[model samples]
Target: MIGFMKKDIAMIKNNLKVLGVLVAFYLIMGLFGEIDMSFILPFMSIAIMISTFSYDELNNWNSYAATFPNGRKNSVKARYLTTVLIILIMTVITIILSLFISYTLNKSIDLEMTFLNMLAMIFGTALVQSFMYPIIFKFGVEKGRIMILVVIFGTVIVGGLFSSVVDLSKILNFLGVFENHWPLVLIVSSIAILYISYLISLRFQLKKEF
Candidate 1:
């Protein structure tokens, strides 16, 4: 497992030059411009991880990896572990950056609320990958990428119709009940989603030909 993670990390390191340039440029804009910078953390992680999957496919890495000891299981485990680590690290980095941006924009840091928002962001990001990884595992990246777009389109259509018919404000008002414990809720929900996603991905990988 550790070796698998190391391989993935090495893959990330291979792209550090390009990643650094984009991250630096985005941070500069967030620091000086009027952009809401919270999106960068999840956006960068997802984009990079998806590209890593593309690399694996291009190299036919999985077929070779399956020749190793428990490789199929470990590969899925390592990917999820590495992804969680990336997101957690990025969340910390974003919070630190938020300190400066918040102070710059408002002359104050609402530490509590900022932390809560970060929790929410993690849950949201993890939720997306939970839907994404299983598809990518069952179908190669090329087809999975198209499936993802379709899923996103369907979600937007459903969301639009639901919003048009449902009373969202009242729903939100009802959900205010979880405001105090939302952090715990987010943490538990994220764990459950990741666990379920890992199981589904593992199943697909175990059955996958390559």
Candidate 2:
């Protein structure tokens, strides 16, 4: 398991400059723009996760990995693990920045709302990955790239429809039920989504021919 994780980390290390640029851009946006940093973290994390697939496909890494014991399973697991790690790291960074912004700008940051948004993004990212990885595992990266755009636009359209159709008061009331427990709910739901995604990816990978 550790080796699999290290393999993913090694892949990411090669893209450190890209990651740095992304973080820098987001930091600038968070500091200057009206947008919340939490909103962007999940999208950034997903993009990074997808790029790993691109790297793997480019280098024929998955085909090479198939020769190792339990390689396919571990590769899928590594991708999921790497994504979770990235989300956790981003959450920490978001918290620190929220604090810094509050202190420097003399504005009060709503820590609870920030946390809730972070949790929502984490769950949203997991849900997106859940739908994405299985397709990539079965279809390879080239087709998977097209699916990525489909997933993104599909999500946006669905979200727009949901907002337009749903009652704002009812939604707020539903959220009110969670009140203090929203974080726990988000954590549990996100973990469940990720586990299901892992199982789906594993099934696809086991049947996939490199």
Candidate 3:
């Protein structure tokens, strides 16, 4: 399990130059401009991980992995573990940078909103991975990429139609009843989604021929 995780981290390490460039750009934007560039790292880490899926497919890593004992299961589990760690590390870095930016600009840190933003980022990144990994595992990355886009577009259309007929404000108001517990709710739900997504991907990979 640790070996598999190291493998993924090793892949990311090879991309350090790109990651450094992104961090440099993020610092420049956040320090000199008013936009909240803190969201960049968390979201960009997801994109990097997705590209790693492409590398895995191209190298037929899963097929080779299946020859090892419990390789498929460990591979999927380790990938998710590595991905979550990356997201968390990126989020933490962003939070610290956000603090510097805020304090530099206003002489104070909005710790509450900063934490809230990080929580939202964690949930959003986790949600995207949960929705993406199963498809990538089942269909391979290339086709799954297109299918994911289609699914997202269809979902947006359906959600738009639903919102047109439904009073979403009421739903928001009801949810606001648990305002103080929003962080806990999001953290729990994100973990649930990631666990479920891992299960689904494991099921697909275990039975797959390659």
Best by TM-score: 3
Residue 133, model 3: Cα distance from true site in angstroms: 0.7
Model 1's TM-score against the true structure:
0.89
> Model 3: per-residue lDDT, tens digit, 1-210?
898999898888888888889888888898887777887899988888988898899999999988888899999999999999999999988877777777777757768877887998899999999999999999998999898999999999999999999999999999998899988988998899999999999999988986
Per-residue CA lDDT of candidate 2, range 1-210, in tens? Answer: 678888778877876787677667776776788776656656777777788888888999888988889888898988898989987886777677677777877888787787788888888888887788888887887998788788789989999999999888898888799887878988998999889988988998988877
Worst 10 residues of 2 by lDDT: 35-44
Model 3 misplaced stretches (Cα beyond 4 Å):
none
Q: How close is candidate 2 to the true structure, as a TM-score?
A: 0.83
User: How should the candidates be ordered by lDDT, best one leading?
Assistant: 3, 1, 2
- Overall lDDT per candidate, in order of appearance: 0.87, 0.81, 0.89
Q: Write the per-residue lDDT of candidate 1 for residues 1-210, one digit (tens) a residue.
A: 999999989898877787677667767887788777677776677877888899999999999999999999999999999889888977887887778666776757778888888998899889888889999998989999898899899999999999999999999999899878999999999999999999999999999985
After superposition, which runs of candidate 2 have C-alpha atoms over 4 Å from their true positions? 148-180
- The candidate, 1 or 3, that scores higher on TM-score is 3
